[model samples]
Target: MVDPAPAQTKLANEQVELNIPIQPLGAAISRYGNATGRDVLYDANLASGRLSSEVRGVFAPDEALNKLLVGTGLKAELITGKTFVLVPVPASQQARQTSSPEHLRYYGLIQAGITDALCDAQGAHPGRYRFTAKLWIAPDGAVVRSRRIGSTGTPRSDHEIDAALRRVQLNKAPPPGFQQPVIILIVPQGPGVTRGCDRP
Candidate 1:
């Protein structure tokens, strides 16, 4: 039997009719979400002083969302089948974070661990979808707590991700003064992309 498409994928491909006009970013997002039956989440401050791009016509929910975000210095990230969060672009985010070698090493370790955990599950692989999360790791390298920003488009996959993360223990502790609630962003791979699930 063929497996059904994941909820995230289905949501992205589903077309919706939208007639949102150029307006405040916050208001536009609201209208888009209401029209598409999806939830859009973002900090109010981020929407302040920003205007949305005009969007009209039938288009995939993702496409409409992208249109609304144009020139707004923000991007819509699907966290679940019906939820999205607006976050600053990667370029802007990178400018605010530490990029030292030590930090990079720790970041790699964290990502590798997360990848392994997600890959172990049938529908929770990283490269196939996109999501964001906040992780609180203890000094001893254990993921003491985790807060997922969105869904994997399915409750089963979301559960798998949460279960996997609860057991994650990095190889080493983070460097001194490392930040808490490490942000993790996983973006979908492009066409013809494939990734093996070899433990890191």
Candidate 2:
């Protein structure tokens, strides 16, 4: 008789808390997967040499993973209710998901604007903090919403990051009906040493 398929691990049913800090992309992912007993399939070539932001909060498996991969340019999708696959996103697709890059110069200009704003804020307030968020830009170069994926420990810092993102003025608005939310991570190079928002 044929062997029965292994029971799939359902992520939605799992509840777990995470306290992972900013580190190499591979290490963070591996650590989380191992701790939660979740099998995460990934390509070493793509995940290698990449850095990820920290994740510290109580959340379900899906929510925790979402926070972990915040600014890593990687996405996780649930397959078979238990399996998670990490995939790289292309620049072209980013536009389609968020909005058509007609006025915006794709991510180059968009990300630069965000980074500059974040750096400016970090310079003003010195501390160890990482803000991971998703921004929904309007068609008229307005920020419709800035949702913080995870806390930056202090409400004060979180407000600063939120304000910074809102302060960003895109040269061109995206195409209507496709205002795709973009991921932005504001973090420090070390402990209260260097602070900059990185796209990777």
Top of the candidates by TM-score: 1
Candidate 1 per-residue lDDT over residues 1-200, each given as its tens digit: 11112223335577987888767777787777667767778888888866666688999988888877764668878787767788877774544444767877888888888877777766677776767877766545767677677876888878877787776779687664354457888777677644546643
Collision pairs in model 2? 9-82, 98-178, 98-180
| lDDT at position 48, candidate 1 | 83
Which window of 10 residues has the lowest lDDT sum in candidate 1?
A: 1-10
lDDT (CA) per prediction: 0.71, 0.63
Tell me the lDDT of candidate 1: 0.71
Best by lDDT: 1
User: What lDDT would candidate 2 get against the real structure?
Assistant: 0.63
Model 2: lowest-lDDT 10 consecutive positions: 1-10
